[model samples]
Target: MPYTPRKAYVVGVGMTKFDKPRGERDYPELGLEASVKALIDAGLTYDQVETAAVGYCYGDSTCGQRALYQLGMTGIPIVNVNNNCSTGSSAFAFAANAIQSGQAECALALGFEKMAAGSLGSAWDDRAQPMEGTMTQLFEIEGDKEYEVDDFGPFAARIFGAAGQEYCEKYGATWDHIAAISAKNHKHSVKNPYAQFRISPSSADVAKARKITREVTLPMCSPTSDGGAAAIVCSEEFVKAHKLEDRAIELAGLGIATDSVKLYEDKSRIELAGADMSRRAAQKAYQQAGITAKDVQVIELHDCFAPNELVTYPALGLCAEGEAHKIVENGDNTYGGKWVVNPSGGLESKGHPLGATGIGMIAYMALQLRNEAGDLQVKDVKHALTHNIGLGGSCVVTVLKKAPFYKEGSHCKDRFGYDFAREERRMTQEELDKVRSKHFSDYLPPSVPESKL
Candidate 1:
């Protein structure tokens, strides 16, 4: 018999301020604090959590053991998940499944990282072998930035550079666009209390800052940071039975997909893969919750880089292919747009702490749904979505709605006033090709023959 999916509700969410990464804070300590706060917010006790899912990347096997030890949370199954940047949502999805399957009434999801004191390069190259030149020279080729370098380090830097150029060329967007994203996030962080960089930057100040390199800039990127975030998930019945305050968000849907690890090796465009994964996830989630993309009033996206958001808009069905840049250029993404994206200030402003990023997205969106977002709140938020991407490019999309769909007489509807849960809008190969072209560009080495995948 097919098992019925459980109706999961977000009962609590919490995170520490995302600031410069500090070694002094241990993983277990940060996780404990976040978990305790989430528990308090959910109106539940630690004893009520029958299971817990912890997400962390770069942390060794014992990291989960160390963190869970802080809360003396033992005996129950505590699964540790590490999916690069999407680790937190991966764990949250697992916990949601557990609650929906009637396995546990209440479960916890915690994400933590101290990457500044820790090593990010370790994730790519454990050896940390320095190139035969200075870090500066190593990043440049004949005084120009190099894009052909494929190993993770230089490759990431070059990708950001290319994206910066692409946005400027295609959309007439400037560094100010990226800065606007960071500035908004910082302002949102101010009220978050748990955000690391709560200091807002003026439009003029952000636009005038010097670039870190040709591609990367101070405001366009997140500083290495240390932080932890946690959440409590439970069944909708569990909340109603307890008569908990109606301050909960329902997990309408969850979806995940993996793209080719060798982006250069794959024939499919990276952007298409991401967008398809998100669309599939949204389809499933919407079908389960009975909502549609038009119904999502708020979004918290993975803005690890500004281009990520620019490209994501079209990929996520927000706009047509090759039109995301144009839409962004017209200020369609600011405070009063058709929909608001990344009100949490994104990774650029909120600071990306690897394991904690996905949870941080959820933490911010939950507040938005509960009308606790303060100045960043959407006027009348009914549905919201959170999207996250991981290493080499894995993607996850989770959707949330204001009310529990299964509640008696609580009709869930999308913008069309039909059920939100439904199949996705299918596309022909031509359409897919167009979207792919927008995401993956042909690499032209001025002097060398282009390497075709």
Candidate 2:
């Protein structure tokens, strides 16, 4: 929360097609595709960026340097961030804060991931697990309850599934309600060209999908994905200087919160899974934006699992406490409903690459505000909210709206020389060259070549 007289705006955004991991591409190619496209979307080159924040969950130190050097060797600050699932938005927050603090008039926030196939696992094994405390808390809560642990699914399933079970217990929500959410997201992804899983399923099919746990099913989770997404954040001065008024989406409010006593003292599985963290962060963002959750028309939350999305509804103040089921049953979370949640299919259908996921949320919302989301666009969306969280844990809540000077579809034709928002097209070498730094290097080749993935 760096204070500044300047307001931050998202002037550019880009995302690669999310795919199931095939190991065909490395992080550099994925990272470069997103970075280059974002630069092109801004109608700017790499040299103009004063600083950069790059995020990824699994990579060596200096990966950001490796990723950015492909654009140029200007030697501006490049920070590498790893905040688990929320890493992408954390990088974005850092970039926005720099603009707000006047440390830089413009900054680049980039997130990329080249994840492996299957469930998320620990990269380090010899040390104490960061999630060990959560496991201890979970066991304490399940004392004498004789539930069998499924050996097949990732630990995250158990964590969120237990919390979802507790939520149902407190509020009398049937598991069908949770399965409906999965079905909705799966159906929504059908129109998203970049989604990894676009096949639609019925609520009954999702509920009957192979059980990950007694309380969790296969379609109820986000699959591991490989992709990259990025945003260009700049100060109001920069936007005016560049005549980007029409394209800029205001970074109206942002709040990041970590674990509190609620995690240890509440004894509520809902709170244990970072719902309290989500609430605190959402409240701060809402207060800053001068908008309530009731005013939100669109939302892109961290639906790493359907249960996560379910618990997050109340946590984000979208509904009253213990009443998330009403929103699901009333059809308020989909198109023609009160709010469109995850029109981009959510993590459940869209795929989740930890670092890129958060920035992807911003990319989607920014498109909505600019009226460029095409068939998936919500009607008349002026204000949007996003909630990204990680367990062990941190949460970043953001409220974004159309900038005062925003004009629908302005600069769309000039941006990337086509309607990129409506279509997910791979960038050409010509397009990449248009945004490369004037001070480009030839001594060493970029980490990734100017080619397709």
Candidate 3:
């Protein structure tokens, strides 16, 4: 039997304010907040969602269910996912595949993380480490180079900084050129209400910041934070049935690429860090969407580190080969440029909550496509792109735009009794009541803001 593909649309999207990990809230509260808000924004109820894919990296198995149980034990399938930093997009891709494959009419994709403060490190010590191969290869490359191999810091900074160093060594882009990309994202973060760091920094500020590595500085890296984000993905058929014509944003094309042999061929550090995976993913997504880089007006790129963003410009075909620094120099990566990249401030400023970052990217991109992003909105955007990646390694590139039936006055103006896009608000009890299942739970968290209120 042949399986015909159907269109998947992100009809609703929501997220919690990406905040420093203060331990004030748990994963359950964060996940539920984003889920309830998403359901309400879609004008749908929990019972209506046929299945779900939830992502969290710092939790035990079924932690997803623990969070979802508050919505009611609907007995719907909830597949838990963990894919390093790309966890949220992995969940999103799961839901999109579910809809497109006709396995479910509607599904939920949710991601949240309650991370430890400071630099991220591995939790498991007994098992064979997943990143061992990449780490070993990174050290080997450094051993052969003229640079000091012992001026190290966090594992993430070292590997990514190596890639940035390579870009400069190979293409004549200086460290300041790499820093400029970080500075640009910091500037963009000011308009994002959900960003963790709203303060802007100049390129010099980035260049001179406390060095994490020779090629990386403090401000150039994403922070460990606590947050959650979610989206409701459904088929076009379901949209018509639910009278959601005015708001649905089509997931026109989606491509997921995993590690190829290039990841460890003793080759470029850029490929070792999986930038080539992003390139391949973008290629597949663009082919599916029937569009080129020229057609995309806005982007929510996975700038996990400043160097990655610069490498990604060429990977995603945003600029000529090794000319990513040119994108920064020409002012083409921000508003009024050729493409407004990382208008959500990107992972660098927006705060990377492991599992939540990818989904947060989707939520922000949805706001832009709906024209409800307010201060951060890109003008006349038709196509928006989101790129999320994880090391050891996978990358998901998604292309989205307004649905054919989309109109100017979307339900966002009144959905959830306010603009879910422009106004960042937690779900009130009244609002939660509108989306939760008729069959419910009394699992109370005394620490949640809404619950405390």
Regions more than 4 Å wrong, model 3: 1-3, 439-450
Which structure is stronger by TM-score: 1 or 2? 2
Model 1 stretches with alpha carbons more than 4 Å out: 117-119, 123-154, 167-176, 202-208, 260-276, 405-453
lDDT of 2 by residue, 17-41 (tens): 8999999878888888899888887
Each candidate: RMSD to true structure? 15.5, 1.7, 1.8
lDDT for model 2, please: 0.89
TM-scores of all models?
0.77, 0.97, 0.96
- Per-candidate clashes come to 15, 0, 0
| Candidate 3 lDDT tens digits, 1-453 | 975589999988889999999998899889999998888878898988999999999999998888887787888999999999999999999989999989999999999999999998889889998898998888888788887777678988888989988999899999998889999999999988888999999999899999987778999999999999999999988998998877799998898999888888847788888888899999999998999999999998988899989988988989888889988899999988999999988999989998898888888888888888888989999999999999989899999999998766655768767766556776687877778788544543332455542
| Candidate 2 or 1, higher lDDT | 2
Candidate models: Cα lDDT each: 0.65, 0.89, 0.88
lDDT of 1 by residue, 218-286 (tens): 565656678888888988778888665465688877877765333333222233224455555556666
